[model samples]
Target: MQKKTDFYFTYPPNLQELDLATMVSMYRDRGEPRKAAPGKYLACAVTHKLLKEAKWWFGLYYSQAAWDELLTKGSEGYPLTEAELNLLGLVLSSETPPHREYVEKNIGTLPKLAYLIVNDIKQFGFLQEDEHGYLRITPRGERALQGISRRIYQKRFTAEMLVVYHESEELHRDDDQRNDQATLF
Candidate 1:
Protein backbone atom coordinates (compact mmCIF):
# COMPACT_ATOMS: atom_id res chain seq x y z
CA MET A 1 0.00 0.00 0.00
CA GLN A 2 1.11 3.54 -0.60
CA LYS A 3 2.27 5.40 2.49
CA LYS A 4 -0.37 7.73 3.83
CA THR A 5 0.51 11.36 4.33
CA ASP A 6 -1.05 14.42 5.90
CA PHE A 7 -1.75 16.99 3.20
CA TYR A 8 -2.41 20.05 5.29
CA PHE A 9 -0.46 23.29 5.37
CA THR A 10 2.76 21.55 6.38
CA TYR A 11 5.04 23.68 4.31
CA PRO A 12 5.76 27.08 5.80
CA PRO A 13 7.83 28.68 3.10
CA ASN A 14 7.28 32.40 2.81
CA LEU A 15 4.69 33.23 0.20
CA GLN A 16 5.76 35.09 -2.90
CA GLU A 17 4.09 37.75 -4.98
CA LEU A 18 2.05 36.37 -7.90
CA ASP A 19 0.53 37.90 -10.98
CA LEU A 20 -2.31 36.59 -13.21
CA ALA A 21 0.12 34.49 -15.26
CA THR A 22 1.48 32.97 -12.06
CA MET A 23 -2.08 32.38 -10.86
CA VAL A 24 -2.85 30.47 -14.04
CA SER A 25 0.34 28.50 -13.47
CA MET A 26 -0.63 27.73 -9.88
CA TYR A 27 -4.01 26.41 -10.90
CA ARG A 28 -2.38 24.35 -13.63
CA ASP A 29 -0.47 22.38 -10.97
CA ARG A 30 -3.80 21.02 -9.73
CA GLY A 31 -4.85 19.81 -13.21
CA GLU A 32 -6.67 22.69 -14.90
CA PRO A 33 -5.14 25.04 -17.44
CA ARG A 34 -6.81 28.39 -16.96
CA LYS A 35 -10.04 29.78 -15.48
CA ALA A 36 -11.71 32.23 -17.86
CA ALA A 37 -13.52 35.42 -16.90
CA PRO A 38 -16.94 37.15 -17.05
CA GLY A 39 -16.41 35.24 -13.90
CA LYS A 40 -17.94 38.05 -11.89
CA TYR A 41 -20.25 35.82 -9.90
CA LEU A 42 -17.57 33.27 -9.18
CA ALA A 43 -14.94 35.87 -8.48
CA CYS A 44 -17.27 37.64 -6.11
CA ALA A 45 -18.10 34.50 -4.20
CA VAL A 46 -14.51 33.31 -3.91
CA THR A 47 -13.04 36.67 -3.07
CA HIS A 48 -15.78 37.34 -0.57
CA LYS A 49 -14.91 34.10 1.15
CA LEU A 50 -11.30 35.25 1.28
CA LEU A 51 -12.30 38.65 2.57
CA LYS A 52 -14.48 37.10 5.26
CA GLU A 53 -11.41 35.22 6.44
CA ALA A 54 -9.22 38.31 6.05
CA LYS A 55 -7.26 36.36 3.47
CA TRP A 56 -8.34 38.11 0.29
CA TRP A 57 -5.20 40.20 0.04
CA PHE A 58 -2.96 37.23 0.76
CA GLY A 59 -4.66 34.78 -1.59
CA LEU A 60 -4.73 36.78 -4.82
CA TYR A 61 -2.47 39.02 -6.87
CA TYR A 62 -4.10 41.61 -9.10
CA SER A 63 -3.29 44.35 -11.55
CA GLN A 64 -5.66 47.23 -12.16
CA ALA A 65 -5.13 47.08 -15.89
CA ALA A 66 -5.23 43.30 -15.96
CA TRP A 67 -8.60 43.12 -14.23
CA ASP A 68 -10.23 45.85 -16.28
CA GLU A 69 -8.76 44.21 -19.30
CA LEU A 70 -10.35 40.90 -18.41
CA LEU A 71 -13.69 42.57 -17.86
CA THR A 72 -13.60 44.30 -21.21
CA LYS A 73 -12.35 41.34 -23.13
CA GLY A 74 -11.79 37.81 -21.76
CA SER A 75 -8.07 37.33 -21.12
CA GLU A 76 -5.33 39.65 -19.87
CA GLY A 77 -2.03 38.20 -21.06
CA TYR A 78 -2.58 38.81 -24.76
CA PRO A 79 -1.92 42.27 -26.16
CA LEU A 80 -5.11 44.31 -25.94
CA THR A 81 -6.79 45.95 -28.94
CA GLU A 82 -6.67 49.72 -29.01
CA ALA A 83 -10.25 50.04 -27.75
CA GLU A 84 -9.70 47.40 -25.05
CA LEU A 85 -6.42 48.91 -23.87
CA ASN A 86 -7.93 52.34 -23.92
CA LEU A 87 -10.85 51.22 -21.77
CA LEU A 88 -8.49 49.49 -19.39
CA GLY A 89 -6.33 52.58 -19.11
CA LEU A 90 -9.33 54.71 -18.30
CA VAL A 91 -10.50 52.36 -15.55
CA LEU A 92 -7.08 51.90 -13.98
CA SER A 93 -6.53 55.63 -13.60
CA SER A 94 -10.04 56.63 -12.58
CA GLU A 95 -11.39 57.08 -9.05
CA THR A 96 -14.52 55.82 -7.30
CA PRO A 97 -17.74 57.13 -8.93
CA PRO A 98 -15.58 57.58 -12.08
CA HIS A 99 -16.21 60.34 -14.58
CA ARG A 100 -19.21 60.06 -16.92
CA GLU A 101 -17.43 61.90 -19.68
CA TYR A 102 -14.25 59.94 -19.19
CA VAL A 103 -16.00 56.63 -19.71
CA GLU A 104 -18.20 57.92 -22.54
CA LYS A 105 -15.29 59.70 -24.17
CA ASN A 106 -13.26 56.53 -23.80
CA ILE A 107 -15.50 53.48 -23.23
CA GLY A 108 -19.25 54.29 -23.11
CA THR A 109 -22.63 53.62 -21.35
CA LEU A 110 -22.96 53.28 -17.55
CA PRO A 111 -24.53 49.82 -17.54
CA LYS A 112 -21.91 48.34 -19.82
CA LEU A 113 -19.01 49.87 -17.94
CA ALA A 114 -20.53 49.03 -14.56
CA TYR A 115 -21.01 45.45 -15.65
CA LEU A 116 -17.30 45.06 -16.25
CA ILE A 117 -16.21 46.93 -13.14
CA VAL A 118 -18.64 45.13 -10.87
CA ASN A 119 -17.21 41.86 -12.02
CA ASP A 120 -13.66 43.05 -11.55
CA ILE A 121 -14.45 44.19 -8.03
CA LYS A 122 -16.25 40.94 -7.42
CA GLN A 123 -13.19 38.92 -8.37
CA PHE A 124 -10.61 41.23 -6.88
CA GLY A 125 -12.86 42.64 -4.13
CA PHE A 126 -13.12 46.36 -3.49
CA LEU A 127 -12.59 49.05 -6.14
CA GLN A 128 -12.53 52.82 -5.85
CA GLU A 129 -14.74 54.64 -8.30
CA ASP A 130 -14.75 58.42 -8.31
CA GLU A 131 -17.68 60.79 -8.80
CA HIS A 132 -16.39 61.33 -12.28
CA GLY A 133 -16.40 57.52 -12.77
CA TYR A 134 -12.65 57.31 -12.31
CA LEU A 135 -11.30 54.23 -10.51
CA ARG A 136 -8.44 54.84 -8.10
CA ILE A 137 -6.91 52.36 -5.68
CA THR A 138 -8.29 51.34 -2.35
CA PRO A 139 -6.06 50.10 0.49
CA ARG A 140 -7.29 46.52 -0.03
CA GLY A 141 -7.02 46.80 -3.78
CA GLU A 142 -3.53 48.27 -3.40
CA ARG A 143 -2.44 45.33 -1.27
CA ALA A 144 -3.49 42.97 -4.07
CA LEU A 145 -1.51 45.05 -6.58
CA GLN A 146 1.62 44.90 -4.39
CA GLY A 147 1.41 41.10 -3.80
CA ILE A 148 1.72 41.48 -0.05
CA SER A 149 -0.71 38.77 0.99
CA ARG A 150 0.07 35.03 1.32
CA ARG A 151 -3.41 33.74 0.67
CA ILE A 152 -2.74 33.99 -3.05
CA TYR A 153 0.52 32.09 -2.59
CA GLN A 154 -0.98 28.62 -2.42
CA LYS A 155 -3.04 26.84 -5.01
CA ARG A 156 -6.56 26.44 -3.68
CA PHE A 157 -5.51 23.36 -1.71
CA THR A 158 -8.67 21.28 -1.40
CA ALA A 159 -6.68 18.07 -1.17
CA GLU A 160 -5.16 19.29 2.06
CA MET A 161 -8.54 19.26 3.77
CA LEU A 162 -9.36 15.80 2.49
CA VAL A 163 -5.96 14.51 3.46
CA VAL A 164 -6.35 15.82 6.98
CA TYR A 165 -9.71 14.12 7.40
CA HIS A 166 -8.37 10.85 6.08
CA GLU A 167 -5.31 11.05 8.27
CA SER A 168 -7.48 11.28 11.36
CA GLU A 169 -9.44 8.24 10.27
CA GLU A 170 -6.20 6.40 9.67
CA LEU A 171 -5.04 7.21 13.15
CA HIS A 172 -8.18 5.60 14.51
CA ARG A 173 -7.49 2.51 12.42
CA ASP A 174 -3.93 2.36 13.76
CA ASP A 175 -5.24 2.59 17.31
CA ASP A 176 -7.59 -0.31 16.62
CA GLN A 177 -4.69 -2.31 15.29
CA ARG A 178 -2.66 -1.55 18.39
CA ASN A 179 -5.51 -2.76 20.55
CA ASP A 180 -5.79 -5.94 18.56
CA GLN A 181 -2.03 -6.57 18.79
CA ALA A 182 -2.08 -6.04 22.54
CA THR A 183 -4.97 -8.45 22.94
CA LEU A 184 -3.14 -11.08 20.90
CA PHE A 185 0.05 -10.74 22.93
Candidate 2:
Protein backbone atom coordinates (compact mmCIF):
# COMPACT_ATOMS: atom_id res chain seq x y z
CA MET A 1 0.00 0.00 0.00
CA GLN A 2 1.10 3.57 -0.72
CA LYS A 3 1.55 6.03 2.09
CA LYS A 4 0.50 9.68 2.06
CA THR A 5 2.61 12.47 3.41
CA ASP A 6 2.33 16.22 3.93
CA PHE A 7 6.07 16.68 4.24
CA TYR A 8 6.40 20.39 3.70
CA PHE A 9 10.09 21.16 3.11
CA THR A 10 11.78 24.50 3.61
CA TYR A 11 15.16 25.15 1.92
CA PRO A 12 17.89 27.05 3.68
CA PRO A 13 20.59 29.44 2.53
CA ASN A 14 24.21 28.25 2.11
CA LEU A 15 22.79 25.20 0.40
CA GLN A 16 25.00 25.34 -2.68
CA GLU A 17 27.86 24.07 -0.54
CA LEU A 18 26.00 21.01 0.74
CA ASP A 19 26.43 17.55 -0.76
CA LEU A 20 22.88 17.08 -2.05
CA ALA A 21 23.40 13.56 -3.38
CA THR A 22 24.68 12.37 -0.02
CA MET A 23 21.82 14.08 1.77
CA VAL A 24 19.33 12.45 -0.56
CA SER A 25 21.04 9.08 -0.24
CA MET A 26 20.72 9.31 3.52
CA TYR A 27 16.95 8.92 3.10
CA ARG A 28 17.35 5.96 0.77
CA ASP A 29 15.93 2.54 1.54
CA ARG A 30 18.95 0.31 0.96
CA GLY A 31 17.68 -3.28 0.48
CA GLU A 32 14.11 -3.37 -0.80
CA PRO A 33 13.01 -3.34 -4.44
CA ARG A 34 13.59 -0.12 -6.36
CA LYS A 35 10.73 2.35 -6.03
CA ALA A 36 12.02 5.11 -8.27
CA ALA A 37 10.04 6.08 -11.37
CA PRO A 38 11.26 7.18 -14.79
CA GLY A 39 9.94 10.72 -14.74
CA LYS A 40 10.04 11.27 -11.00
CA TYR A 41 13.24 12.35 -9.22
CA LEU A 42 14.53 14.14 -6.19
CA ALA A 43 14.67 17.92 -6.59
CA CYS A 44 18.47 17.98 -6.58
CA ALA A 45 18.72 15.69 -9.57
CA VAL A 46 17.79 18.35 -12.08
CA THR A 47 18.68 16.43 -15.21
CA HIS A 48 15.85 17.39 -17.55
CA LYS A 49 13.64 20.44 -17.68
CA LEU A 50 11.42 20.67 -14.64
CA LEU A 51 7.77 21.69 -14.60
CA LYS A 52 7.01 25.31 -13.70
CA GLU A 53 4.62 24.05 -11.04
CA ALA A 54 7.71 22.78 -9.18
CA LYS A 55 8.51 26.32 -8.14
CA TRP A 56 5.21 26.52 -6.31
CA TRP A 57 5.14 22.95 -5.03
CA PHE A 58 8.64 22.66 -3.59
CA GLY A 59 9.69 26.23 -3.16
CA LEU A 60 7.71 29.33 -2.04
CA TYR A 61 5.78 29.01 1.22
CA TYR A 62 7.89 26.03 2.17
CA SER A 63 10.98 28.19 1.87
CA GLN A 64 10.04 31.53 3.35
CA ALA A 65 12.66 33.45 1.38
CA ALA A 66 11.44 32.02 -1.87
CA TRP A 67 7.86 32.76 -0.85
CA ASP A 68 8.63 36.40 -0.15
CA GLU A 69 10.51 36.79 -3.40
CA LEU A 70 7.69 35.16 -5.32
CA LEU A 71 5.28 37.77 -4.00
CA THR A 72 7.60 40.55 -5.11
CA LYS A 73 7.86 39.41 -8.71
CA GLY A 74 5.74 38.43 -11.68
CA SER A 75 6.37 35.62 -14.17
CA GLU A 76 8.29 35.90 -17.41
CA GLY A 77 7.78 34.28 -20.79
CA TYR A 78 8.57 30.64 -21.54
CA PRO A 79 11.57 29.47 -19.54
CA LEU A 80 14.89 28.66 -21.19
CA THR A 81 17.12 25.72 -20.45
CA GLU A 82 20.60 26.21 -19.01
CA ALA A 83 22.13 26.01 -22.46
CA GLU A 84 19.65 28.50 -23.85
CA LEU A 85 20.30 30.92 -21.00
CA ASN A 86 24.07 30.57 -21.38
CA LEU A 87 23.92 31.40 -25.07
CA LEU A 88 21.70 34.36 -24.43
CA GLY A 89 24.00 35.66 -21.70
CA LEU A 90 27.02 35.28 -23.96
CA VAL A 91 25.32 37.15 -26.76
CA LEU A 92 24.19 39.86 -24.36
CA SER A 93 27.74 40.32 -23.06
CA SER A 94 29.44 40.31 -26.44
CA GLU A 95 31.37 43.50 -27.15
CA THR A 96 31.79 42.53 -30.77
CA PRO A 97 29.45 40.76 -33.13
CA PRO A 98 29.32 37.02 -32.33
CA HIS A 99 28.75 34.66 -35.18
CA ARG A 100 27.93 30.97 -34.89
CA GLU A 101 31.63 30.08 -35.03
CA TYR A 102 32.43 32.44 -32.17
CA VAL A 103 29.71 30.92 -30.02
CA GLU A 104 31.08 27.41 -30.58
CA LYS A 105 34.49 28.57 -29.47
CA ASN A 106 33.31 30.26 -26.28
CA ILE A 107 30.33 28.16 -25.18
CA GLY A 108 32.34 24.90 -25.50
CA THR A 109 29.47 22.83 -26.83
CA LEU A 110 29.45 20.50 -29.80
CA PRO A 111 29.07 22.45 -33.05
CA LYS A 112 25.67 20.96 -33.82
CA LEU A 113 24.23 21.86 -30.41
CA ALA A 114 25.62 25.36 -30.67
CA TYR A 115 23.95 25.82 -34.04
CA LEU A 116 20.60 24.72 -32.65
CA ILE A 117 20.85 27.01 -29.60
CA VAL A 118 21.73 29.98 -31.80
CA ASN A 119 18.83 29.29 -34.08
CA ASP A 120 16.55 28.86 -31.08
CA ILE A 121 17.62 32.21 -29.74
CA LYS A 122 16.82 33.80 -33.07
CA GLN A 123 13.43 32.11 -33.17
CA PHE A 124 12.67 33.61 -29.79
CA GLY A 125 13.49 37.06 -31.28
CA PHE A 126 16.32 37.66 -28.86
CA LEU A 127 19.01 37.49 -31.51
CA GLN A 128 19.55 38.54 -35.12
CA GLU A 129 22.06 37.93 -37.87
CA ASP A 130 23.66 40.77 -39.73
CA GLU A 131 24.69 41.01 -43.39
CA HIS A 132 28.11 39.75 -42.34
CA GLY A 133 26.54 36.88 -40.42
CA TYR A 134 27.41 38.49 -37.12
CA LEU A 135 24.84 38.10 -34.35
CA ARG A 136 23.30 40.92 -32.39
CA ILE A 137 20.98 40.95 -29.39
CA THR A 138 17.81 42.97 -29.89
CA PRO A 139 16.23 45.23 -27.31
CA ARG A 140 13.58 42.62 -26.71
CA GLY A 141 16.31 40.01 -26.41
CA GLU A 142 17.95 42.06 -23.67
CA ARG A 143 14.69 42.16 -21.75
CA ALA A 144 14.17 38.46 -22.23
CA LEU A 145 17.67 37.71 -20.97
CA GLN A 146 16.99 39.80 -17.88
CA GLY A 147 13.82 37.86 -17.18
CA ILE A 148 15.57 34.54 -17.68
CA SER A 149 18.41 35.49 -15.36
CA ARG A 150 15.94 36.42 -12.63
CA ARG A 151 14.03 33.18 -13.11
CA ILE A 152 17.19 31.07 -12.89
CA TYR A 153 18.33 32.85 -9.73
CA GLN A 154 15.00 32.21 -8.04
CA LYS A 155 15.04 28.51 -8.91
CA ARG A 156 18.60 27.92 -7.73
CA PHE A 157 18.15 29.87 -4.49
CA THR A 158 14.92 28.12 -3.64
CA ALA A 159 16.36 24.72 -4.43
CA GLU A 160 19.28 25.37 -2.10
CA MET A 161 16.93 26.32 0.70
CA LEU A 162 14.80 23.23 0.16
CA VAL A 163 17.91 21.02 0.46
CA VAL A 164 19.03 22.68 3.62
CA TYR A 165 15.60 22.29 5.15
CA HIS A 166 15.50 18.57 4.37
CA GLU A 167 19.02 18.07 5.76
CA SER A 168 17.78 18.91 9.23
CA GLU A 169 15.03 16.32 9.22
CA GLU A 170 15.07 13.03 11.14
CA LEU A 171 14.28 10.59 8.33
CA HIS A 172 14.05 6.81 8.63
CA ARG A 173 15.94 4.47 6.33
CA ASP A 174 13.95 1.99 4.31
CA ASP A 175 14.92 -0.62 1.69
CA ASP A 176 13.41 0.86 -1.46
CA GLN A 177 15.96 2.89 -3.44
CA ARG A 178 14.94 4.67 -6.60
CA ASN A 179 16.17 7.93 -8.10
CA ASP A 180 13.05 9.03 -9.88
CA GLN A 181 10.32 7.62 -7.73
CA ALA A 182 7.32 9.90 -7.93
CA THR A 183 5.83 10.75 -4.62
CA LEU A 184 2.28 9.45 -4.33
CA PHE A 185 0.56 12.31 -2.61
What Cα-based lDDT does every candidate model obtain?
A: 0.35, 0.45
Task: Give lDDT tens digits, candidate 2, residues 37-108.
Answer: 567632322223332222332122112233234321221333344445456666666678777677654543
Clashing pairs for predicted structure model 2, backbone only: 11-161, 11-162, 12-161, 29-174, 29-175, 32-175, 37-180, 37-181, 40-180
Model 2 global lDDT (CA atoms, 0 to 1): 0.45
Cα RMSD for candidates in order: 21.6, 19.5
Q: Residue-wise lDDT of candidate 1 within 31-147, one digit each (tens)?
A: 112233443322322223211111112234223332332222223222122222233434444444455344444432233433543445534544555555555545544333322
Estimated TM-score for each candidate: 0.22, 0.41
lDDT of 1 at 162: 27
- Residue 157 of model 2 has an lDDT of 25
Candidate 1: stretches off by over 4 Å: 1-114, 119-124, 130-134, 146-185
Worst 10 residues of 1 by lDDT: 49-58
Work out how many backbone clashes candidate 2 has: 9
Give one clash count per candidate, in the order shown: 27, 9
